[model samples]
Target chain A: MPGHGAAYFGKLAFGLVVMFAILAGLQAAPRRSRKIIIAFFTFLGGLYFALEFFYPAPSGENFLTGYQPLVAGLGAVIGSFAIGLGVFSLVQLHLRTLSRLRPGWGYSIVLLVSFVAMTVFGLMNEYSPNATVIPTVGGLWQSQNAHGMFRFLFSGGLSNLGSATFSIIAFYIASAAYRAFRLRSIEATLLMAAALIVMVGSVSFGTALTAGIHPKLTDGSENPWANLRIENIAQWLLMEVNTPAQRGILFGLTLGLLATSLRYWLSLERGAYFDKEL
Target chain B: MQHASENWWVSGLVVLLSLIIIGKVLSAQRGRVPFIRRIPGLNAIDEAVGRATEMGRPVMMVPGISGLDVVTLQALSIFSYVARAVARFGNKSIMATIDPIVTGVAEETLRDAYADAGRPELFEEGDVRYLTGQQFAFATGVAGILIREKVAASFLFGAFYAESLIFAEVGQQVGAIQVAGTTQTNQIPFLIAACDYVVIGDEFYAASAYLSRDPTLLGSIVGQDYCKLLLLGIILIGIISTSLLTLIHGGPVAHLLHTLVDFLKVK
Candidate 1:
């Protein structure tokens, strides 16, 4: 039992060392060799998923299926590394801007300060105990300090800023829609008309306008001619017309995805990534 | 396993199509260059880069918010060509990605492009950046870069969602020559509305091939078309058979139509 923790730490150290060694080797390799290594690994990784999907296993319990969770765990690990790299890149760029006293260096300073503040408070919030055994007050606020600071930063600061940023889309949509809905051609006019109908039909006004379109049936059924209602017309346009168009585009996208996936999996893709000699 | 057995036909079709694509790639590699129609958006890449060079401003390339998927990879391929052009013209180019993995790959791509252009020294590490992974944050960062950097050309290619219009509209406001491409059906209208040139549907996939003009890629495009034609033929047969069965009102034609539908149906 005492050696169990040491063994686990030993394995962790070994893994980290191996990973760094591999990364160093990759960085040291020539460009052509690096690309070949990348391509070969890409093919192998893709082939695993392909086989896992296509191969029929009894009770879906195959070698790849069993290893699927491991693969996903590895992906998560890599994703964590990517996040670290992203943060590092951000900090590096901002620090360079600040040191150089660039035109927007003041903004960079603010960004760095915010980044550090958020990260520190976030970590504190995560690690701090939930029990309010030690209550500390700052100024007029009575406090559960760490959790309160994080909650204020996240809910009040981050959420509000995010919402403000997202709200910019309303103005953008207005401008974009105005330009798009311009009556430059017959097609544009028809588009605008359809847009109007759909817009109105979704509200009570359009339904009220067509409220009198009830038709009697011999079998005492609901009105068959109710399809002529503005709401019904808009529904038909969306379901029959818009849906079909979207489906057609989706079909094209699917085929395109398949073709592109094949090209990458086979390493037959023609680009700077693939065209280079190995 | 039972479900797999029921869906065997789907797998068969996928394998068959993949084989056809591989065959076309091989045949084209053996010196058979297929003719590909000009993709206007792809053709405009040079013009866009040239405009940026003339205006003495950097070109901005955003690979959308999607991670390192095939779409983003394809976008990077196009970015390689654009970066090469920018390198040759002695103009700066910036690539902003929301994913760090994409940023790493994009940096390599820009480095390779500059190397190919015989200007490896000109490659700037600061140019290709990993803007925040958050959607709106990434959009805002890119928008700031577009306006602050005063980019002359904007290239938006890859998978996008709501942020497509924001980037396109911001580029429009900056008076950049925008060439956007995406397979995102919902975002295509926004791109078309805001961009000067738009690559729609599968054209986004064909961009690398169109830009590179490689035989293998061109052949793959041709093979995709052949598959499309095959699909069209099958659709036509289904339609005609269905129509005939409807007109006959349940007979031998109906039986044949039922068989055809069953054969095509999944599970």
Candidate 2:
């Protein structure tokens, strides 16, 4: 047998050759043939990871370590490239719209411009490790050094924007809760009650509000309810009621995911996954 | 691990089975394929699109910040269906995405839906916009769109994290009728708090099948449930056997049970 490195290189070359041949064949094939090939690749690409993960490896004296993982990684890489190809196609289509000066093509122009700008900045930053930047303005991103520039763009600018965007949800939650939590029916009432308890139990003030309420039977600190800690109640709910229910939901989700994956892997999924013949 | 069977044969089998199923579906399309019942959350699609049209407002569709993963693809499928409806209604649909790849797919889906509806003229390429890939950047962009566009209805579906609350909240703030779904358990509470209708966990997967009423898809879903039952049985067996082994005196059965449990446990 050849050495491991030689074998690995030989295999890689063979794979690359096969891929190129398939691509060439796909290009030459008729429409139906192409579609079938695409579907075949899609199925292989989709389920390879799940199979490696969920299906147990055969037990033997000597372990087969590298092969399954390599296959899984290659499958993932190919699948990812397929998605990338789709994105590239989309960008190309939009670029064509801008070139043709299609109506409302200005938006396409903005998109292309932003996309190109981000790509350039991102790539340049990646390639140039020790580039220097001079501080210009705003306390937020004034630093001119390379590290400073990276921090400004990735951490300061991107992170803050993300955080600020997410923070608004707090206001929206209050509003939604106000509208949705009305005691309109029995189920609604129960839901609202649960919501109220959970929400109150999560906050610090809620603990203080209930802290003075003494347990009926005990005065010792060892008493479960004596401290009347809201956080404690919340933890109890999460650990006792919430964990099991969540686990059950998770159990159902795992099965659903597995089944869906299996059907796809086995080529049994119909409807949305399978395109209807036009 | 890497047998020719693992590479070519497994792939071939998967392809063959899938093609056979697809062929069966196509052949069966001629006759009355048994009707699959509509899921209630899916029933709201028409109403949601119609609400936007009647109000002359845009519909906000956020396909989570997840990348071009399976969950995101599932979200895109639903978005395509919804976009088609909006196109038919002559209503606007706004899609905000974190992944450039997903943005690309969503745009294609929207454009295709419009083209399919014979209203390609109504499609706005920029309507399917790329927000930043950063978790919060996408969330904020969605929130801004919700607030600025005064969206009549919001559809937030896909993989999400803490940003789920942010998106749903923005929809709520705009007073938009919201329908949210995701597989993320951590984000479900946030969605439940803010969205009008929620499809949690596997329900999200069932959305397209429910809306389309395709029996083949419904059968796949039932098949999925059966698989879940199998998983449940496995879990029960594992737990019971492990427990019994721990309780009983040492024996070959006990040793076997211990081995099984140990093998299954991940470090």
Candidate 3:
């Protein structure tokens, strides 16, 4: 469809009608048949990706290969619209809370105020003619400015608040590490030792402590003795031990993901959501 | 010898994995079912819910801060079982989601679970909430919920980032028994440190199977183990052969092995 035109509106109307019609039809269908319908569509989508991916085409591209972006974009498009649905939910919840004078009604007021402020300032900052770049200051029209409010709200308010929240993690980490690294068990002891080594290895003081231990001799030959250096030991532990351990977990994780994905694509997944009578 | 992403190896592996999983599923339907191993995190969920019931406090679940992906879906699936248990005990279950669709799906899942448990009236509209999509905002919001509601148990299952620790710490402060499960390995340590029980590795993916004890799902988990075994076997052979070939220096067999490995690295 055209981006903007009478034709675009006509096509958009038709699409909406068609979507609603399909939804109504699905809703009206018998319960058992609905499962089959879901299974069929799921299989079709899965088959497309499977063939497009697995088929070693002589031409270097399968027939269904070109639509990959479009398929992915469809997901993005749906997700973008889903944000609206999320906003609506937030608004409804807050509005209801406010109307009922709930215990946290004050927080609801703050939330609604912030939501409206962000959405308005964000839209205006993006589309307003006077919303010039701070340094560049180049645009077609330089009319009224919503840019100051937008910047203040986003950078001065939301970003700083987010940063403050993120900074709190440092304190929490200390608390958690204190609990985890306590000398209670052998495993905890080893974990503490390892954490200590990794932490020290990451600092300049650690490097300074082991600066006398050179990796190379005066004649530019290998110095085997340097392997005992603190930094070197830390590097060895991370590369030789930590990496292999992570890889082992990764192997299991990848295989599990593959199996689960296969179950989903084939519509053979059972239990909870999948098996629930829709 | 060759880049893994430039060949058909992945396709072959995917097909094999699919065959194995589907075969197990069908076999399970035919009366042969596999036994699932013990997962302490899953068992802890029941204890958490029971604790909430006894304390007259609500059970809380955060289905991740991400959109409706496979990870979130898995989290929600686990939550479904949790919801059922809460329903049976006549305790409130609060689910906070960062994704709008997750909130919607979780609401439906909770409703179904309640209906299944013969406690449809226990379901509440305000229980399933959509917090902000922004990361820390959702974290703070959930933390506020934990503090305000004084929940007896907290279930954090999904893809979590830095805010995971925030949840864990807040749950700790409120004296909530926390059970956390995530595929993200980096977050596992923090969860282990703060949570009463931590579900790590593939166990997160295996949660639904553990909870429901569904025959087909159990079979699929078994198949995953078999697939992992096959992978280990291949890796072992490769390592041994490579070591031997290094000493040999040059040979047709070594060259052939190298080519096979390269070709198997699917593009």
Candidate 4:
């Protein structure tokens, strides 16, 4: 294990250096490693999950639960860096755009100004304890108000805008379905019929349609088939038919994903991760 | 919620099936094979890229909001093929990735694809850009790219969420030839609504086999279907036996069916 540790650290340093070097090379020199690092990571990620499941735990300690601390720390670090990278990229892009004064350059200027202001206020609130004293640039980092503004801007502005845009789907769906649901051909008719049935069947209206049908203790009097509860019929169709089709498709997809993953992880993917031919 | 013994049986079956598939594919690779069914959506990629090339426009590929998940990586695999085709035909591709890790991989994918096509000089690191981790920000950035660049064809595939509709709508508005696919059941409605060609659920996985028409891939696909058929057969038997027993009121068949169900009962 100690021997592996030395190799591991060496690999880590080598990998990190290679990462920066490759990033630099990407901009300067077009040369790249022949190896599939993405596939390597993908395989390692899969292995982590596989090991977590297949590897049994010893007595007195749980497997995943015990590793929570390590996992959480790593996740936090990764998450922070991701955020930082986004901010950095945004800043750089906007700054360049503003300097060049490209077409619609004003938008970039607005973006940069808003982003910088928000970030400054965010930092101020993080470090500031008191709001009354307007200290130097460093003091703003200590202001609670600044932090509150960042939360408000993020939660109120960006979050709301995103949600509102997403919610517009309701209108889009209604419009699209109306236009496309026209019965022009047999296939279209069949699709419409299926859609209508499935839509009704999944809702409470479908169940209510067959509320008259009762499950009687004595079935000698009348046949249950005569009732033909739509909801029950829908449930039958879903369980007997739709579910099977879905399961089949899901199973095929699962296998495809597995095979594709194996290909990538093993670096067998052609025309990917290397440009030897080129 | 199943018992450990039951889990073992399922696992064993999976391993057995996998081995059989591997063996079959290996054998087929060393020989000729049968014809595989064509997938229209995947077949359209070449024409889509060609149209973009003719117009002197870039092709945009959005791998959805999925990170390095299996579905995302599968999308990446398909993207590799698409990118190579684009590079070969002297077309440009811009991949707007939501995941940094995926962006990195996508960059490599494009790089390798260009290299494969003998056009490494055209590969641009800036093309494989990471937009944002947030779902909407990623969607907005991709939409921005589509509108600003006036990309000719957009390929949306992977695990999309709320932003699926937004992305699809933007692509639609751009008048770009859009081919969208996803396994996300809820988002399928949106994709089906806006995309010119939509790959629903498992159809996304069939891209490689469909596009390449490689026998090994096709054989594996068929093998997968065979497994699915077997599972379906078992479930059908279960349902039929259960229904018949229930209909018959009470008999030996009913008792036998009940016992069988109990014996195979899962949590």
Candidate 5:
């Protein structure tokens, strides 16, 4: 038998050769042939997942279930390659902007610098020794390593920036709610009432508002008919009123999903993507 | 993880519904265009594109931050139609996608749309962008584009989460003609609140059919309605049976209701 290293290299070379051959064949094929091939593979892939989901097994394990890990690994590999494409697209756009020196080119430069710094530090963080393995420096310089750089950039910079961006949504939601809650119509008035009830019911102030309304009862028996509490009313509104509406919407959404999926599975979906010649 | 044995009824129902849809599609292919109600949100796509053309401003289309899925694919189909409309009127369209796979597909769809409009040269590589895979990062990037481009029209379709309002509100602030649609029921209210036109519920999925006027899609939409009617019947039966069982306090009706509930149960 060949050495382990030699065997590994042989397998790697075989995989590369197969990949290149497939790529070449795809490139050489006619557009119609390519489409047919794609459709056939799409059908096969969809069928596999569908069967895996629906097929019964006495042991609660099917043929496809046994290969689920392999399938997932394949998906991860594809996703990783797609990430590379995403990065390439980002770099291409920002580089073009910087070269052209557009009005907001400075922002593009900042984006590129951030991207490079984050990527380098993130890779270093992944490959570096754990915090336990690395010696702790004294004073505020305890983590002066690659992992620290990544943590600062990721947690301190990117995460905070993301949080700041998300915080902007509070203002937007307020504005949207303000506009939406305008008492221009009966519907708006009803919505406002519901919103007010829900908002009031969610906080401690809501309990205080109802505390004075209810008389103190000497018996420890719970009053089943007590719907006067804002919290209870809110819960009833959500569970009774909101739930039904949501269910109605969900029913429609699922039927729609089924229809669309059927269209795609049957290759009946026609448009630029389907009918147009490659 | 109920297998087919445990959930055979669901599988059977799904198969039956799929067959019905396929049959309808086949019938539609024979030149029978099914009648569909006027979907105002879909109707507004043309108006949005027209306004963009008249203003000489770009149109912005975001297919949400979802990876490649049925929702994203449906969004892309609508994007194709929008791109074609923009191409016809010599207007630019910018598609900001969060997924690289979606970006590649959107690029191809845009190119095809331009070619179909007989203006392939107008399709720009930079127009179809992959902003970021991160959710909030994608939202921020799209918001930046909406503000900077001063887009005349904004189209939001596909799966959206918390960022739905951010896009809709920003578009509203920009005073753009915003048409939004998503299968996410949670985001529907936000879109309705902030957008000029909001396609609710299944209407988001029917967008391609409504926009394209393709017979196959229209027929499928009709079949979907049929399945919905069937579901309505089932729900009515369930309600009636349960009410009768409660009122009668245990009888044959109760047994039937119990059986129906058991049959429909997932596990």
Candidate 6:
């Protein structure tokens, strides 16, 4: 970004054209060979990351480490093209719905308008000089600039909608807890007891109830019985019990991820997606 | 993560485990596949598809909000299995993706799946949708689909964050039979509470192999179990050594253990 000029733009354009040509060629290639070719590239990419991680270096950085960012940047650029395809797909669907006056055509209108407004403002905000905060006499027109419009749509509209939608989850949680906390089985009872302890221990009332259970008793002797305090029980459950269970799950999760990666890196996964042809 | 050169002692364990996993995979391919217990969620997803087929409604799948990572890829594999089932029953399947590349890949995956089922026309581009790449926006869009289509079944797989509850709750509201799998431990509780079936932790990864019964995957899972045993052995050894040393309090063996542990630790 710092050294960009005519030469960089030219090279970028040339690289894009080369990439496009290669992709087109791959598309035109035989189906069986295409799978092999794709798998080969996938292996190369995975190998780079794998070695970068596993290979030891005297200076604490492997040879491939420095190229990691560049590779990631290239991947991001290619991914942006996929976004282009997604946009095309979305727009095509909405256009069909609007033309046919589908049942939910009104929602389609809202989507398209928002899409266009956000895209226009977002692009302008990115390319244009920073919009100066203009002192204005009009209240509603205070943020009429590209920055303001984008902020109005993004933070004010999208953010609020998202937050409100997410807020509904608290109610869902309450309902779910009501159903899950029933004393139906041993597991359920244990869960309920733990939940009750955690809930009570987290609050002031529970602590107040155990206020007399001081770490040191009135006679100035160590009070081992203080461990029975509600807060202490809750702290033990969270730190000693809950954390260990979470770690246990994480251990399995990490190993599972390792196995899945090996399956993909080796192209050993068998399915229509992976073994469509050869 | 420190470089292996800086922490070769720790890296040695990782490398050894990886070799075992690879070995198991190769061994499985040679007809020595290990057994994987039934993942109840697999049947649930299949049954959900069948229910949707009976109801004449589409089955919706949200493959998390991540990009083209291993998590999303596995989610896509499961989606492919669901698509194949849907195609077989002359039912429709919908996929809402939060990543553009995943949307493209999901489209191709479903197209191939439908073709495999000899129902190429059933694979509509409209069904494999590219919802907004934004997380909450995708949630809102997917919620709309769940409510409007009243899909009989919804499958939520992959790494979900805060929006996990939104999808499950909405599907529940629509009386959709939901099968959710996620490696996010925190999200698992919410999923378990709301969905009819939920896969937690590493079980999320096993969902694919259970559905496809691929020998390679079963072997990899067995290798993972072996690695788990290896970890348990190491942990037990560490606990015993530390306890004995604590009791003895200062000896050559304790000193050696301390040195070895310090060496393995990140500098």
* Alpha-carbon lDDT, every model: 0.84, 0.69, 0.84, 0.70, 0.85, 0.86
After superposition, which runs of candidate 3 have C-alpha atoms over 4 Å from their true positions? Answer: A1-14, A57-61, A125-144, A216-221, A276-278, B1-5, B251-267
Every model's TM-score: 0.92, 0.71, 0.90, 0.78, 0.91, 0.93
Using DockQ as the measure, the top candidate is: 5
lDDT of 3 by residue, B181-202 (tens): 8878889889999999998888
User: How would you class the docking of model 3?
Assistant: medium
Candidate DockQ values, in order, are 0.55, 0.26, 0.52, 0.36, 0.71, 0.70
TM-score of the first chain alone, every candidate: 0.86, 0.64, 0.82, 0.65, 0.82, 0.87
Cα error, candidate 1, residue A112 (Å): 1.0
Off by over 4 Å in 1: A1-11, A30-32, A58-61, A129-139, A215-227, B1-6, B249-252
Cα lDDT of model 1 by residue, A28-124, tens digit: 9998898889899989989888888777776755656778788888777677767777778878988999999988888798889888878877777
- For residues A126-157, write the lDDT of model 5, one tens digit per residue: 65525332456676455467777788888998
Q: Give the per-residue lDDT digits (tens) of candidate 4, residues B194-247.
A: 788887656787776677666666666666666667667767777877777768
- Candidate 6: residue pairs that collide: none
Candidate 5 colliding pairs: none
Where's the lowest-lDDT run of ten residues in candidate 2 chain B? B1-10
Worst 10 residues of 4 chain A by lDDT: A269-278
What C-alpha lDDT does candidate 3 achieve relative to the native structure? 0.84
lDDT of 4 by residue, A51-154 (tens): 55445444423455466577557556555445556556556666676788876678677667767766676666566623533334674564345556676677
Question: Which predicted model would earn the best lDDT?
Answer: 6
Candidate 2 per-residue lDDT over residues B1-267, each given as its tens digit: 433333453444444444444444444444535445456777788898898899999998888777776677778878878988998999989887777667666777788788878899888756876655567656665776688678999998888887787777767667788898888888787787777788877788777667656665555555455455655676787788878976976888888888777754533
**Model 2, total clashes:** 5
TM-score of chain B of 2: 0.81
Off by over 4 Å in 2: A1-29, A50-121, A129-147, A196-236, A266-273, B1-38, B115-121, B227-267
- Candidate 1: DockQ? 0.55
Clashing pairs in 3: B5-B267, B6-B267, B7-B266, B7-B267, B9-B266
lDDT by residue (tens digit), candidate 6, A1-278? 23357997898899889989988999999989898998898899899887888887788787778998898997998897899999999999899999999889999999999999888877766655256544566775553567877788889999998888778778878887887888989998999999899999999998888988789988899899999999999999999999999999999999999888887887878875568364
* Pairwise lDDT winner, candidates 4 and 6: 6
Worst 10 residues of 5 chain B by lDDT: B1-10
| Candidate 3 local lDDT, A33-69, one digit each (tens) | 8878987887787787766766656666666777889
